[model samples]
Target: MRILIVHNLLWAHYKASVFQALQHLVDQQPDLSIRVLQIARNERSRASLETATDADTPTYTYQYELLFDRFLEDISLTERAQALLRHARAYKPDVINLTGYYDPAQLLLLAWAKLNGIRVVMQNESTAADHQRSGWKELFKRSVFRACDGFFCFGSQSADYLIQLGVPPAKILLRKNAVDNEALRAVYEQTLPNRTRLQQSLHLQTNNFVFVGRLIEVKNLPMLLNAFAEALKRSVNALNWGLILLGDGDQWAELSQQIGSLKLTDRVTLLPGRPWFRVPEVLALSNVLVLPSRSEPWGLVVNEAMVCGLPVIVSERCGCVQDLVHPDETGFVFDPEEPDKLTQLMVKFMDDLVDTQRMAYYAQQYIAPYAPDVVAQEMLDGFREITN
Candidate 1:
């Protein structure tokens, strides 16, 4: 059995870890072969997330091919489609796993695979709450979902969306998203000793609620800032806590202005987005992770935070909230629209209402099941079930 997996970006370390494990599993099967076709090295919006990985040029050792040695946006749709079709025809795969429905090229490949009687597994991350669902897009996605033989999703929320879009529950192969937990844990543990010094050097408070991602409007940064300010006002241990925004985006100027107006300029610090590997360094100095996005698909940063032994305060809208967060046990989930709810949750941490150390332990324990090895095993099983 020859399997071709089409992916959009090559710089995703989490996906790379899963693929590496999948490749290892496939290697044990003498008659099975799996290869990935990465459309581009990285997306433009996520260029800052790229880090200086180890000796491996691709960051992970996996059997894969790169369609273009550039970002997908730089290439035209025609170019992408032609290259994908050319590669698909050459590989002549019996089964194909498509990245998602957004990419026209991959959708075209899905169509071709169906016409050629090839099995197709669709991977999706979008949730019903992530954005305003369009009737036309839903109609198109329903058609695509109906045509695919199996589905892999980010989490329960994504799987639920697929089911709502007309996919059968049995066909929902996997509903897990993960990071390279071991790698992240190692990096965080190694940097643990320097965390205090690093925080001092950066003038960060003893306890910080860190938000790491682009400063895009969809991230709901303004609301996060407002909630953090309120939390600080309500904080009894005022000297130790602060908010750290570890990303740069188009909203920098606006966010800066809001920080000043809220009188949180001293309490809030804005840092540029760093590479993926170096994230552990930031995570080491932080007490908690906060993702207050109005629209988040899966929020992989939550996984990263949990792997680093930090409890997360995630928005209810994030796809991972249901699967990863345990409502004040692992961490708290708040409605993004209710800034006051976020404020109260943050206050729980600041006022010593919740045991941070215990919650961190719980987070690590809860996240164990979402490891790449586990997800890869599910993927392998899904492939076997569909092909059989």
Candidate 2:
């Protein structure tokens, strides 16, 4: 069986890892083979991440074609649609998997696939609570969902959204979104010995809560700052705990100013964004991972942290919270809207109320099912199920 996947970003290392794993499966299985059509090298905003990671050598192994080899924003919609349709026709896949529900370019390909009797599988990331759902958009999404033969969702939240839209539960294939666990864990373990030197050289505290991603407004950085500040005030071990924001965005200046205004200049560290492959190195410098996004699709950083054996303090709104968080076992979850709730969770770690070592163990064990080889096999099985 030939499976064609249409994905937008070439810079997405997490997706690349899964594709690499799937390709490995194809080599062994022989009957199942796949092709990925990557639309662009990177998004304009994430261009910084494309630089100098082991210089010129790719991090993960995968087979894919770069449709544009440029940033997604630089390509015109007409060009995108034409290129996608052209490739879909040439591949003549038995089944085609779309990256998301939106993108008229891919939507047109979806329509073409259904008309030609090629099975369609949707790869979804959006969840019900992450965005404002207007009636017209939801109606459009329903129409899109109706065309697909199967679904591969990011988590329970995304699969639930499809079920709500009238899709049969049997058609939902997978609920796992993954990163290169082996790679991240390797980096984390290798850097563990040098962690003390790294932290001292960077002037970071002995224990810190690390946030890794773009510093945009939707991430709710200001609220995280306020919550962290409040936690500091309430904890006796405040002097030993700190917060690190590791990414850059429009909110960079605003967040920097807020850090000072909150009198958290000494306790908070704002580092520029690094490549996703290097994230576990930063993970080595910190004690826990925190993602307080007001609206997040799946928050893959939570997976990265778990792979590195760090307990996470994720917001309840993140799609990952449903699968990756287990409140006191794997980690804790709280509402992003309430500063006190986040503050209290932070205090648990600071006051040694939560057993970090035990929770870290649970996090690693809990995330095992989301590993690359395991997730790839599930995806391959879904393809076999739908095409049969």
In lDDT terms, which candidate is top?
Answer: 2
Please report the TM-score between candidate 2 and the true structure.
0.97
- What is the C-alpha RMSD, rounded to one decimal, of candidate 2? 1.4
Worst 10 residues of 1 by lDDT: 51-60
**lDDT of all the models against the reference?**
0.90, 0.91
Task: Mark the regions of model 1 whose C-alpha exceeds 4 Å error after superposition.
Answer: 51-58
lDDT of 1 by residue, 281-321 (tens): 89998999999998899999999999888989999999999
* True-vs-predicted CA distance for residue 139, candidate 2, Å: 0.9
- Runs in model 2 deviating more than 4 A are 53-58
Q: TM-score for all predictions?
A: 0.96, 0.97
lDDT tens digits, residue span 56-118, model 2: 234666678999989999999899999999988888899998988778888989989989999
State how far residue 58 of model 2 sits from its true place (Å): 5.1
- Give the lDDT of residue 376 in candidate 1: 88
All models, RMSD in angstroms: 1.6, 1.4
